[model samples]
Target chain A: MPLGLNFTQIFLHLFNFLLLFAILYFLLYKPVKNFMVHRQEVYRKEAEETSQNLEKSEKARAEYEEKLAQADREIAGLKAKSGEEAQAHYDRQVKAAKDEAEKILRDAREEAERQKAAIVQEAQKDISDLVTDAAEKLALHQSSQENFEKFLDTVEAGRAEAKN
Target chain B: MSKKQQRKMTVIFVVIGVLLLAGIFLTAGASAQEEDIVTVIRDAVIHDTNKIALFGLEVNPGLISGLAVTGILTVFALIVRIFVIPKFTLVPGRFQMILETMVGYFSGLAEDSSPHKNRLLSAYIFAAGLYIFTGTMLELFGIQVVTTAGHSVALPAPLSDINGAIMMGCTSYLFIVVGGILNNGLGGVKGALKEFSLPISMSFRLFGALVSGAIVTELVYYYTALSYVVPVLVGVLFTCLHALIQAYVLTMLVALFYGEVSEPSEKKLRKLAAKAQKTEVRTAEAA
Candidate 1:
């Protein structure tokens, strides 16, 4: 068996490597590790803050959205109620106007009918009085004419008696 | 003619003088105080590195520029008005009037924030806001907050990281305090605190908006390998858009906070009137 490395040489190389490792640990590895740890701490804190901020934003957004929706609902309900009320008001006004118009028309028709009946009754009474008067005048005239003719006959009889 | 009498009067006056001096000295000595007082000013400034990093805290150039300009202008204007204009006030100059008007305007703005109609609050707010804005802009020139491995990190440029934190903290604190005072005065102290919520949101909101816009714009520019002008234009446009959005949001929050306490009475009056009208209508119908 052929040994490529002597024991003393091997041990010396090992010691040299160990020294290098120690120096690297202090100069590069330790500092690097510390820096990385600090950076990580900062990162972790930042992540937590960001997450908290996101949560707050989400909560605020949800609250705002809820308020907006509630306002919309209130507005819609108000409009519907106002519309219903307006419609009711219009209907009531129309009904009152129609009733007033009907009442006025009925009153006018009644007055006209009464006036027409009074006029017809007055005409009939006037016509009947005129016919009665005419009949009385005719009767008087006939009686008077008969009496005059009788008087003329008497005068003729008296003259004949005196001559005898 | 009266030298002996004069001498006697002088002696009496001198005696009174000495007596008065002695009384003054006695009072002064009696009032003298010597006490060893150790006042501890606990300026406990609590800060979180993570919170600062998450917001990508940086210097603001616009704020810094605005402050420098405003300061220079104030000093120049003050010097000119106080010295130069006073020398020529006999002519009733336009410059004097202009100066007066400017002062009056600032005074009025100050009065709005003052506790008892004073200009101190206004002046303080203006100065602080200007300083904060300027410092923020200066910090923005180099400091950047970046996300790596799903965690945010504050990568400082030339300035130290602590300085960056302090700059951002100062800016946020200034805005919060001033806005709180104004809001509180307009509403109440509690309301002011409630109003402070707006600034708290703004602290992060402005940063978030700017960072997101920058990232997107940078990504687009990178992928497109756009020209210098293109990148600059995109960056400016992004910044402007972000600014407009931030302003709108801030305005909305202020208005909302103010409105919460102001609008209810008017609403109540309107409701009462409506109810009265309904009752009147009902009475008329019954009649």
Candidate 2:
């Protein structure tokens, strides 16, 4: 064959190569390619699952933080409310005590005034009675003193009659 | 001299003496030959004519070699599929790593060329690359078979035949056409038509490169004086280089052209642009 170029050989070579290509494509290329694709899909699915898990955990963490913040706000509000209520209660207790002390002072003053008035009244009555008894005793114990006191009274009466 | 240095020097002298004696014996054997040795440059061009009658049809020796290569590849693929692939883990083993590297390289090439149709093209390119590489390197084994002329001939690389190169080139062209059609319909076919000479050029290129190596190696072996050490060096270097280079060139061309044909049509691109412009105008008016 000149230059090894034979039409028949060329045709045969083409046929043989095509056959080989077909066989290899089916037997080797297709299966290996499918395996690689399957492995890639597995890796992608794993990555997607990991990403989803991360998202869920992040969402849960955010919710927990939000709840914690709300609890703190509530605690703060409760603390302020309790403080205000305690101050009001303290003020109410102090005002009530002051009113009770003023009432007690007024009651004591009234009682003392009543007792002093009663004691003064009793002393005045005793002094009048004692003075009356002293006059009666003097009249009984001294007859001359009595006569002189009567003569003085009669003379003083006759002079009064003459002048009338 | 010290004792140790003297002993070392004696050992060196003994080795040199033995080498000189062997050289003298070789020269004597060579001079004793009665007839001068002459190397005849046999026609080492690959031929498809010698028909091995397989079920009544004349078969080419190159075709037989191609079939043998196919068989070897099949067994290797099967072994990898059955034993090697199953053992592969997320962290790859050595064999698995090699396989992955090969697949990843081809797939990456396909992706770079044709992003949309990379999946369809990667398999064919990988198959073509493996075929070319193995077929070219197959000649290195020097497997001999008796021809129809009752002469023993070394099996040649399949691509050394013009027919095999044509087939591969045409097949790649076919893939380009199909890729275009799938991506762009009739427009894709029109795009693929532009590369009608691709197959012919590709075929000749592959055939020429491989045949040239064969021819050069044959010429080297033809001279008796240059035959012994030079032929082996020439043959191995040429074969390996052709195997790697031809495989890469063909696969690269196919991927590059296939990517070109599979792109979106100009009309479609224009429509998208117009739609985007309209949206922009409407938003501007609203603002």
TM-score for all models, in order of appearance = 0.26, 0.66
Q: Which candidate tops DockQ?
A: 2
> Candidate 2 residues A95-117, lDDT tens each?
99988888888887887778766
Each candidate: what lDDT? 0.44, 0.75
lDDT (10s digit) by residue, model 1, range A1-164: 12121233223323332343343334333333344446568789999999999999999999999999999999999999999999999999999988998888888888887776665555444544543454455555656776556645654554454334
CAPRI grade, predicted model 2: incorrect
**What ranges in model 1 sit over 4 Å off?**
A1-4, A114-164, B1-287
TM-score of chain A of 2: 0.51
Number of the predicted model whose TM-score against the real structure is largest: 2
lDDT of 1 by residue, B234-277 (tens): 55564455444543443333333433433224455688789999
DockQ of every predicted complex? 0.00, 0.23
Q: What DockQ would candidate 1 receive versus the native complex? A: 0.00
